[model samples]
Target: MLWGCFSSAGTGKLVRIEGKMDGAKYREIIEENLMQSAKDLRLGRRFIFQQDNDPKHTARATKEWFGLKNVNVLKWPSQSPDLNPIENLWQDLKIAVHRRSPSNLTELHLFCQEEWTNLSISRCAKLVETYPKRLAAFNGKPGDLIVINRLAYHHWAIYIGENEVVHLDPEGGDSSSSLELLSFRGEVKRQKLTDLVANDSYQVKNLLDQRYRARDHYVIVKEASSMVGRQLSYNDDTYNSQHFARDLRYGEAESRQVRRAACPAWAGLAAARAATNDFSDRRLLYRSLKRLSK
Candidate 1:
């Protein structure tokens, strides 16, 4: 296999590896290639390394080496290839090499080196420029669904495009009340997406329609809009934001009977078990939630 690093300016160093890479060898490559690249680009301490969650890349020894070097690495999403711009560069290089149709492994290596050198800084910069938009696109879309964890509770909302989401808020008071609650402070209301997500961790809960058949987008928005001024009673065991979301998406009330059986402190886990009916996998859920909290 081959390993390499690149930045917005161009390719850094390319290393050819004949076999598996262990933590020590991986650390050596990073120290040699990345450190030199940092110096060449004059990035110094400001350069942040990016790597996928490969076993060698994330091994304890490799992490310790990065710590000793005081190099900052970008926290990358696991199993997300599209988030890595270098993947695109790899694809381009592969295409270029294949077009030459080298007759032997030696020729192939030479072609790879030539193609890597030919990659322009302007092309790399364009890829880097798309990073922010790519992140935004990954985060959400219009009419997209989101689930936010607010400590012991979870809330649901529907994105309405342009950095805004509408959700059913119990604190907004009943539709008949004339008092206006503070922004995101009460009731079913529309709030800036940032405000809703502020100080909270969220997950994109949509796009799992095959696993949990979601309602039509128009229906979801209509249901959300209709509930805007209505004050829904909040009952942790029976009805709440989560249940509201379930009702809108699945047309069924979320049963919290199992959660009710447990103490409020353990309700989250109990509810998850009730929903999945897989006690053995509860630890996985806990682990995922713990990781997201960090």
Candidate 2:
């Protein structure tokens, strides 16, 4: 879900959250979502001004529908100042979500929006002074900086609040990195080790994904067991039935020999990098930054 920022501080209060959403909806759909979130703010009778850069749809299919007389579409900076506080606010809000599970998705969305309203503007201003940290991160190891960040538990936060920017999102949503798992899993060291294991669950996941790819290339077929062979089946058809592929017969006895070697989490990370076929140092850095920008 996406939400818009509106500030009553005249023209200065702007909502600056950056996130990615999929698919395209009609302009009315976009406006309706924003309107609903606006209502969620409980702003009462105050006239909170809202502005946005020209979204593609504004000039396309739903242009007329969205050209409301009161709505203002402001011009945007090619590269805006790091002084904007909402940037840091977004980081902290994400951190909260990454650290704890909300009651549900509705609660999660409301919590983030509430955090934004409650964030201290003064703290976000302080982060503006640290803008050099970002420039330096880019200048010194523009390449390595992203790698260090990407490999972090999730990702680092640059928290923006009423005044200070709290760095957030140290890791990510998947097994490769789990900020939530690390925060609540167990002792830091033991949890780190457990997270590093990439358990049977993870292996089977990879196998299933690989099976689909193979099928696309005509390397596999669709029978219960045709996933890896022309005719195959397993006692547990539940997982296979859902994925429409054969389950890993770990009992195949061949799986037991799987180089079951593992080291400390940090060392394991290094080994993972070396053993992984797709972990290109530069390519990964490029991809990581691109992902953040989006």
Candidate 3:
């Protein structure tokens, strides 16, 4: 597992946990990194630390350490992940590191650290600026579409209420370590919104509401819940997470990402230009297009 933190200023130190992290190890990490990170970010002594209520994080020793250091800790709410903007950074970091496809533990560590450092301060500011929007809370009702920004792509989920969602998850699962590569096979899962999103920025988006009449909320919830244990075929070039969510909401499965990949932007531009009669010399244009394609 990785432990990282970021303020509105920018990212802090990102460290890999070598083994099972107990209270002592957790305290040690905070002792060694937290103050230095705060100093590096220039948060000053008044910045309040925010952390989940994990047992290790809130352990007696850990609390005492914070007290001794005169650290102020934010009283984070349970199951309310949307309040934390750092989760968005974590999501971006994971995507950036995974794209590198680290060969081993060494490369994984290097990539994680490098990517953390490479996170732009501007992006952090944007996340903080939009903090209020995320704070509107998971105001999504049952059967609403929840879209999580995954940097390069969007992950969709069908909200079933009570802070739970049903979504397509990769069969390979999330890589807790750099060794695991993401795969295309998918499984439908019903899990807490916080757990599924896990520090990622998300918004409740029922984009097709105006385009297509929505099915009854009860029916949508029932159908989505029934899919909890089902295994779904997943191919990036065909079906994917967006397709699954759209199917649940619209009764039709379509993947824009797949369509885009099939006909790339350049290919579409070339086709459109080729169809136009405005070109001075069609043969010259064709020759240039052929060379570009090559």
Error of 2 at 288 (Å): 29
Model 1 TM-score (2 dp): 0.48
Q: Count the backbone clashes (under 3 Å) in each candidate.
A: 6, 30, 1
Candidate 1 lDDT by residue in tens digits, 1-294: 788877787778888876667887887788778888777756768788888788898898888898999999889766342356676677788889999999999999999988988999887887788767656655665556777766545677776555567876655543232231111223678776656655355667763456566667777667767767656654433455555655665555222332354456555654464445333212234434555587
Estimate every model's Cα lDDT from 0 to 1: 0.65, 0.32, 0.74
| Candidate that would win on TM-score | 3
**TM-scores of all predicted structures:** 0.48, 0.29, 0.59
Candidate 1 residue spans exceeding 4 A from truth: 79-82, 140-294
lDDT of 3 by residue, 30-76 (tens): 99899999999999999888787889988888899999999999886
Give the CA lDDT, 0 to 100, for residue 110 in model 1. Answer: 91
Instruction: Return the candidate ranking by TM-score, descending.
Output: 3, 1, 2
Which regions in candidate 3 have their CA more than 4 angstroms from the true location? 140-156, 160-164, 168-187, 190-226, 229-294
Candidate 2, poorest ten consecutive residues by summed lDDT: 185-194
Q: Write the per-residue lDDT of candidate 2 for residues 1-294, one digit (tens) a residue.
A: 444453322112223333543224435445555545445544444333323233543454444544552443434333232223334445666766666678887777666666656555455455444434543432211101111212322121111111121111112112233222112111101111112221111111223233232222112211211222222121111111112222122222222223122123334353344344333222233334455587
In Å, residue 244's CA in model 1 sits off its true spot by 31
lDDT of 2: 0.32
